[model samples]
Structures are given as structure tokens and as C-alpha cells.
Target: MSAVMISRKVRKWEKLPGKNTFCCDGRVMMARQKGVFYLTLFLIIGTCALFFGFECPYLAVHLSAAIPVFAAVLFLFVMAMLLRTSFSDPGVLPRALPEEATFIEMEIEAANGNVPSGQRPPPRIRNIEINNQIVKLKYCYTCKIFRPPRASHCSICDNCVDRFDHHCPWVGNCVGKRNYRYFYLFTLSLSLLTIYIFTFDIVHVVMRSVEDGFLSALKETPGTVLEVLVCFFTLWSVVGLTGFHTYLISLNQTTNEDIKGSWSGKNRVQNPYSHKNIFKNCCEVLCGPAYPSVLDRRGLMHEDSPVSASSAAPSSSSSSLSFSNNSKPAPPTTKTTAPLIPNEHTPDDAKASIGVSAEQSCSPEDLPPSFIPPLASPETDAEASVAKDNSH
Candidate 1:
């Protein structure tokens, strides 16, 4: 039967080491620390229950029925936006594979060469131009890659989020490229809900006061007092947050950028992500096409996947052919039990190095830069020279 077929499939999210919680078998994702998210729910649902129970009935009969209808719509919208922001992937970038990391380190060393024994190496920062403006991409040692433009590593989540806005405990997810729109809408609608509830509670109190004075009306319906206090206290913070986010949206900026004063005009690097038009910026942020999550958390991996096959086969990561073959999907070498040092000499490397004839060995000059290693050892240097002579 061609060596009995072994079938064992695992979900990507289950095997991931990311500091996130998975629910519904991987459909709902959130930060592991979800205490604040529950508090946010309690506050929202509690306020809604109070308003609908106490004020909505009185307002509907005496005042226009549209008042309760509008409140209900706002409440539902706020809940939907909150859930969307809380449960969605925030555009997390995958960690670099061992081979990919080795390639990057080799390229960095090739470009910058080596420093003196007493001298310190320069920081791994690369400058890239965006919209005629220069932006520096800093290397994140945690993620083992130079973070892309607008990407930042969140300490709380222990993940590099693309276009990271902020780690919002209230929503239990990092506000980032994928779910920023929903987060913005949540804050905007929540502020309106607070204002609507507060205004109607006062209107209900005044109508009751006309019949039985203000003090007696307050005594009769205690829920209005609770609703007023909750809304009154929450009003400023909610409205202020909405306004602040609106300002950020207008500038096409994030809370992270604003805090860092990235585009405050005081620094040389202005916000390159902006289009320089307020209307366009607002539309781009609010109405732009949604970005799909790149984490691939739901991808199925069977026992015989490329990831497993790559491990069982002979190591060819240091060769040109292997690099070209692995250009599609990242290899699973990073997950190996052995420590991964790009230039570390394995027993296999030593054996191959001795068995292969100098004439058969390919030169670094003939191969693409993808598999080139740093000049770390004299043996490697001698091998390179021998390969170069053969190529010539």
C-alpha cells in the first residue's frame, strides 16, 4: 500500500506560539489577557439594559417611539463594531524562518562587512523611501526580521503587528491594519450611544417632573438616576476618544505615530502614509478596501506537508537551488530542536564539506546572493577561493 498513509492534520492556530487566545476552534482570536475586554462588555451591556428598561418605555409612550428605535439601532451597531474589532486578526507578520533569517544576516554582513575587534557593530536599521520621503525600518530581534513600514512589535501580544495603532485592552486585541476601521467605528458609535442615552434620561426626568416635581420623580424611578450618572461620567471620555480618533483619521495617522510625534513637523520625517488631503485621508481610512489577515491562522497542515518533508530531507538551505525552491512558503527549520545559528557548522555540513571536490563546489560569484554566507571561518574562505578558481 506504498508505505501506509499516515494522516494527522493540525490547525495553524493550535500549533502557533503567538501570545493570543483562540476560540471557536480558531474563528475568534484575541489577546490572552482579556480581563479588560470583559469589563468593557459589562459597562456597555449594563448601560444599555438600564436605558432600555427604565427610560425607553416612558419615552416611547409619552415622547416619539423613534427615540427608543434610534437608541436600539445605535446599541446594536456599537456591539457589532466592538465584536468585530475584538475578535479579528490585527495584521500580524509571521516570524522569519531559519533559512530566511540566515539569508538576511548574510546579506547584512556582506553589505556592511566586518568591524574591528574593539569596535561595536552598527544598529540594524535600513532606510527606505516612501513618497519621496525617507523612512527607517528598524530590525526587530524578536520577530527576526526588519519590520516593514508602519509595523511595530507589541510587547503585550509578543507579536509584530503591521501598521500597528495601539494595544487596546478594552477590545483585547492590538489595533492594527486589518481591524483599525472597525475599532474607529466602535469608538464613534459608542460615544453617540452614551450621548443619546444621557439626553433621553434627562428628557424623561423633566417630563415626570412636570407631573410630580423633580425630587419626587427621582424617587419614583431610580434607574434614570443610575443611567444619568453612568452616561454623565462616561460621556467626556467616550466623546474625547471619538474626537481624538477622528483627528487621527483626518491625518491618516495612528495613535502610536501621534505619541511618537512622527509627523508633528518638528522632525525631519513627516507622515509618508498620508495623501496630503484631509478628505482623501478620511476616505482612505474609513472607506478603503479592507486588508486581509496574513497570519494564515486557519491553514491546515497535514503530516506530509512541505514543512515536514523539508525536515526529513538532506539540508540544502545553504545552496542556491534550495533557496529558489523555498521562495514560495517558509520552511519549518526554525521549529527544529537544535539551536539555529546561520553559520553554525553541523556534522552534515562538515561531512559534505569534506566529501565534495573543490572542482565541483560552486562559487559564491556564480550563485545568487540569497545563499551567500558571511566570511566567518578560514575553511569557508578557502572553499570560496577554490570555487572561484573553478568558475573562472
Candidate 2:
């Protein structure tokens, strides 16, 4: 008896094509990028201090120190979330080879008379119908498996991510199932921080301007003007991102799915994945389940669903059958029918039926018909034939 091996472990990122060496140096590169991100954060903080503290000393000294403290704390929280998002596993699917092998073994046993022939399993079916519409689960040829609904292959990361959001160039990672919460938190916190900074900078400018004339204050506090402008410009993008994510969380949809127009198709009003309760959706996204559940291709959540031969064998066969059916060409149509005009019709009647006048056949308008090639006259053909015979 052949032993069945099952790999419960999710596919590793480094094992993906063109990533063999990335595994060795990926951490180093990631660390470097993360350092760069941290440096950027510090630069923003330094800019805020330089403008707010040095340029507007009067406003800085008089204002409650607690404002800067609060902003610092918020910034740190955003940093933490950003780090989490960058490092967290993005819900990779397990490679199908092990499961596929087990299915093959079962089929072989049945064929060899080890199992009753009547009990032979149905072929594996990958495409399934949902809401009266046939929906094909996305199969990653690289991963060699059918990914769950809402999951997508990220070409950049070279991995299929579950509940795939979008790959953030800033974070230098794919924002997906395990890290989506962190990404959302980071966006929300960053938006709040920008808003706070913008407000604080505006207040500082106004307070200093009131003490001195507006032009003198502007000259004296150039840093404050810079900080205010920077924050004001950055505020809208951060706020918009936060708002968009908040809406997505409420609907239990991912950025990828929303952009792909997956939600509005047949499942528009009746999206099974969404709990339909905003509060529930938020809790599910933010807090997550106490026990992790495996999401099937249909997006159905299952806890401790044992992988038995009985269950696995049928799906494997079905998938193979589906592949075969899709690969095979459609049967040619055998039924031949007579033309609209019967062959027994006279040439004049045929011309009349075709709505073409004999006079128009040789007309200049029809001389250059795009589809028809020019034909040589009988005289030209006879001359060519006679010339060929004489040459012979």
C-alpha cells in the first residue's frame, strides 16, 4: 500500500519561479526597504518638528505639548500596522500535488478491483455553478491548484493570495488575507495623523499671524507654511484611501474584487461572502475568527473539514473530467442543408433572386469588389495554354 502524503503547509513565496535566490536575499532586501520606510516616517516627523517647533516658536511654546505627544503616538501606531502588513503571510494556497496524488491512488485502486467498480468515483469537476450561473474557480498553473473565490495571482509577488487586495509599492508587499486588517488600520491611522497635523499646523500659523502682522508672520514662520502645505496636500489622498477601505470593510469586499467588478455580476444583490451586517463584516475583518476556518473555492468557510479519500477522490476525478471536456473540440455539425436558391434554378432566375442585374455584373461599380479576385478571360487563358504548348 502506498502511503499518502498531505502538505498542510501553505506554499512558500521563495519557492515560486524566479524566487529561488530571492529566498536567500529576500529578507535582506525586505529589511533594507523597511529601513527606508522607517527613514521616510522619521523625515516626515522631522519636517513637522522643524516647521512647527523652530519656525513658530511662540505658537509651539504656548500650545499644549500633549498635541505633539498624541501625534507621535498615532504615528507609532501607523508604523506598527505598516510593519505588520509588510511581514504578515498573505494567505497562500497549498500546492495541489499531494491531494492530486491521493486522488489518483483511489482511482487506481478502483480500476485494479481493490474497491468495487460500482463505487468508482465521478471525475473531478473544477467549475461549479453558483446562483444558476457557471463560475469557474481560478486555477493557478504555477501553484497547480484552484484558488478560492476572491483570491488572485499577484504577478509581482508570484503567489496566489487569498482575499487578495492590492500590492502596495510603498509597503513593498502584497496586502491580502492575513495582512488586510493591518493595511486598513495603517491607512486609517495615517489619514487621522495627516488630518491632525494639518489642523495643528493651520492653528499654529493663525495664532502666530494674529500676534504679528500676516506678512511678518509668514516671513518669520516659513517652516510652518511648508508643514501646513505638505499636510494639506497629503491629507486628501490618505483620507480618500481610508474612506474607500472603510466602505470595502463594511461590504466585506477586497480592492481586487471591487476593481474587477466581481461583486456586481450575477451575485450583485446576493453576495454570499458578505454577512450583510455592517457590524459583523467589520468584526470579521478586524478581529477575525477565534479559530481559523479554511475557505473553500466557493468561499464557504469550513472548520476542521477532514480530508478523506472519499471526499478528495471525487473532486480530483471531476477536475480531470472538466479539464478533458474543456480540452476536447466541439463535434462538427453533420446536418447539411440546401442553399436558399435550388441548383435547378435558371441563371436569370438565380441572378434575380440574388438581387443582381446582368447589366450590373460588368459595371464599374462592381469591377473593384473588394472580396472577389480578377478572373482572366477565356481568350487570355487560351493564349497562355497555346504559348505553354508551343514552348513544350
Q: Pick the candidate with the highest TM-score.
A: 1
What would the per-residue lDDT of candidate 1 be over residues 176-272, giving only the tens digit for each residue?
A: 9999999999999999999888988888899999999999999978888888888899999889999999999999999999998888856667788
TM-score of every model versus the real structure: 0.75, 0.57
List of clashing residue pairs for candidate 2: 123-317, 123-318, 124-317, 124-318, 124-319, 125-318, 125-319
Model 2 / residue 84 / CA error / Å: 1.6
Candidate 2: segments with Cα more than 4 A from true spot: 1-43, 49-52, 55-60, 94-136, 266-269, 290-392
Model 1 stretches with alpha carbons more than 4 Å out:
1-7, 302-392
Model 1 lowest lDDT segment of ten: 304-313
